[model samples]
Target chain A: MALEGELAAMMAAAQRGDAAAYRALLKACLPVVAGIARAQGVRGEAVDDVVQDTLMTVHAARASYDPARPFLPWLGAITRRRAIDRLRRAGRRPVEVHDPLAFEAEADPGPAPGAHLETRERGAALARAVAALPEGQRQAVEHLGLRELSLEETAALTGRTKGALKVNLHRAIKALRASLTREGE
Target chain B: MAARHEQLVEDLAGRLAPVRPLPRPGLRAAAWLGAALLLGAVLAMRFAAVGMEGQAPADFQLAMVGALLTAIAAAYAAFVTSVPGRPVGWALLPLPPAALWLGASGLGCLRAWVSPIPDLHGEHEAVGCLGFLVCVSIPLSLLIVAMLRRACPLRPNLTAALAGLAVAAAAATLLAPFHPHDTALVDIFTHAVVVAGVIGVNVLAGGRLLTRG
Candidate 1:
């Protein structure tokens, strides 16, 4: 005798392009997926991200499931992979140090008008100047400087090697200084 | 932008398109039956050319049938177990047929169970036997995997292992007629080693390929 069941049948219908069935199946599997993720040591925002990623992975991999078979092992496999991926990604990223003065305004106000104008001009010039650098440098500035992201974030988001990101940032800053100096004249 | 769960499900469902399932087990069996017949014909032709003729013994005949049966059952097991949460015991479907095959080997198989110390410097022909078994198993395993590709397999290693076993069993059966100086000990030993090696390799490497997320 074979075990006949709901999850497999639901998934089968979902794969048939039945929107309602797909939603219902996804809803049903969420708890099990979440539980699996939590059991694997994923916590907080990362847990939800892992779960979402698992859902997306499953959606992408849905066609590989057989309706005739029981469904847990297939779901478990995908869930396990996503969770592992998240863990690795989190593990490899550098922690961002806290800045005590981040929210606290400068203790003393700087010299006004002329400096601000020079700074404003420099800011405008830097924005325009950044565009002139090579694409890699430009991207590094965009993520690390303009976006105020940490090196780890930039590396993770852009999928660039950390060393490459550092080089690009350094080069971009050097290029900007040269461009700004020319503008100063 | 909002809840990741609803957003993902909504996104996937919005873009979802599903294809027709592969033909049922009966059709698959029929197709394999054709493959078996073709292989039998090829073997027959080779036998004729070699001026070799002999009736397949009663037990070997049963062994051949068992191999084919194991292949089919294990293939189905691989497909079924691809579904998430399926009982792992489904992977055991190959057992009865496997039992029949070894039983057909008679006491000679049991007597030959004394394996020599394993060696890296094995005879060239023994290495050739491994290659031959793998060559036969690959196509059969690929077909099994392709059939199950429509189903999401949760246990990639287990699913792949079963498929490997099935394909290896079928390959082992095919090797019998061409093998020189066949003995039950050699037959059982060779097939077991071949099947185990193939399954081990597949179970190790096939996990990601079968259950890629």
Candidate 2:
């Protein structure tokens, strides 16, 4: 209660254009905002981002604060909002793959005999499976995957919708994988 | 990161200027509601001068009260919920009044459908009513949205929706005085569609407008 009152007083002064008091208020708010961010499941570097966002909101919205109202809950609400926004953005974006070596071994200790023959057979089987796809799927695979054309180019060449090309490409890959698996078996 | 944080504090402090805080939500709501009612009254007087034809239905006053209360509640909610930490449930404050308004209007429409009052006035044009509602609501929405923009609403869509409801309800209240005719099913449906449209546009665009600052 004392802390809340103290913070409220600082904010009240800040609203009155007390520069030093404003600085003190923001400095005091830093850890509380960060703590709130962490509690909201924001981790590591993103915690700093949420802190910055929340402070910016506070700065922009300072006049909206009521002196009669407790400051902490107001601050808490802003902090939680920014934290959730950051989390939602992270959810929408693709996760970055930092180190490939984390997923794959750094070095293969040894190679089995007939590896070259196995690779050739697998490649041939993949080719056959791709060829057996529906015309649209085959074209999508040929232009998008095998020839590595950009989606725009593939769509123009095939007169197919970009959406259709994507669906076909996805289906082609799935069919190729099943076909290759059956051949290996 | 720590140095940057310190720098931000310095920057904010450097820019600090005394600000007169906004009035409390209730007070702000009252100010806005007053302006809206004044405008509504002016519009009603204009329509009445132009010689709107039919008599106001028995339930007209009830619907007007409902709509007026809705505007007050919704405007208040819009301002209150725009401040962070306020419950989102504040957005629901206008629901009861909204229901009352809708029910009264629906009953008016039903009565019209059942009895088929001859177009005695013949002056009430559905398009005119639509035009009046749309025109009246636009300024109301714009004014309230401008006021709401001063605060940081975490849920901009919800806040804007409340503003929309307030504007729509206030505009609808004026319709009783402006048109002074029994509402046909088409007329009531038109009102519903316009109300939904106002709220929809607010939810879609008003949120962005509020956050643009």
Candidate 3:
């Protein structure tokens, strides 16, 4: 409560032309915002971006501050929004509740490089096999496997349900594996 | 990191132009009440009072008072919310007044229901009453929004919504006296729509727009 009260007072002073207090508040808020973003499951490059965006948002929305309210709820709301926006931008919006039941079926990638000519032939064979699939399967492979979009984002872009996208992706992977195995044999 | 801090500090200095704490709620409440009264007087001069044109409802004055109180309380709440870190509960300041105003509108609707008057749907005078309310609210809202923007509300939409609600309700107060044609329910429904519109617009976009602070 003291920290909360302290931040609120600093925020008020910062509102009142106290530049030093403003800087202190921003600095103090950085780690907190970053932690919040991380807790939302943001990782690596996206983490810093979300934190930066939250900071910028906080700076911009300072006028709407209410002295009667706890400061964290306001900050928390902004932080969560910036994190979601980041996730949305990355095309990684999670579709399901993220249980263990989900399967991420990647397109059969070419085997690890052996002889250079063999690698080239196998890569070409894999590409041809992918191209031969139905358009829906091909699109699913490209979006979910090649571009690494989540099921939700792929569904959104393709105007299909998550279930449909998952089915298409799974089928594409199965077809690719069979085609590659037959060619190898 | 140090460089970022320095830059942020510099930005804060640049942004800190004129820091004005919101006026006390009582002061803001009184100011809106006075402004409503003054505007009502002027409107009365231009167009005769509703009583002059027809036998005004018995609760017209009471409804006007309720609207004024709504204006006052909401204006105070808006001001309080604009200052970041204030308790969220302070936004509740307008609830009682808003309820009072709504209750008064209910009575007016009840009266309209029993009497020969059109209930809510047929009140064509609503158009003019709404117009008058907007006319009064626009300036009041601008002033409050200006105040809110200076404070740099953390929740820009919430602050803007309250500011809009306050001024619009303030305008409704003045319109209540001059508007004899609007049934109570019409005032409530129309005013609610306008206020919600204000809130929605601010939430969607105004929050981004009001960040000058």
For lDDT, the strongest prediction is 2
* Tens digit of per-residue lDDT, candidate 3, span B27-142: 65576557666876887898776534566665666666777777777777776666544566878887887777777777777876677553334456678766776677666655
Ranking by lDDT: 2, 1, 3
Candidate 3 deviant stretches above 4 angstroms? A1-25, A36-43, A57-105, A108-185, B1-38, B52-62, B87-100, B117-130, B181-208, B211-213
Estimate candidate 2's alpha-carbon lDDT, on a 0 to 1 scale: 0.86
Per-residue lDDT of candidate 1, residues A1-185 (tens digit): 12227777878998788888888788778888888999999988888887888888788777656677677767876787789888999988865434455535545476875887888887788878987889999999999988999999999998999999999999999988888888889
Question: Which portions of model 2 show Cα errors greater than 4 Å?
Answer: A96-185, B49-55, B121-124
Query: lDDT scores for all predictions?
Result: 0.72, 0.86, 0.71
Looking at model 1 chain B, report the run of 10 residues with the lowest lDDT sum: B113-122
lDDT of 3 at B177: 54
> What tens-digit string does per-residue lDDT give for candidate 2 at B8-121?
889889999998788899999999988887887787566664434455666766777898889889999999999887777888889999999888888888888889877645
Best by TM-score: 2
Candidate 3 structure quality by residue, lDDT tens digits, A1-185: 78788899888887776877887888788788878999988888788777677777676666555566678877877787678778877776565435335544444366655678877887788789999999999999999998999988898899999888888989999999998889888
Q: After superposition, how far is residue B12 of candidate 1 from its true place, in Å?
A: 1.8
TM-score of chain A of each: 0.49, 0.53, 0.50
Backbone clashes, candidate 2 = 0
DockQ of each: 0.26, 0.45, 0.15
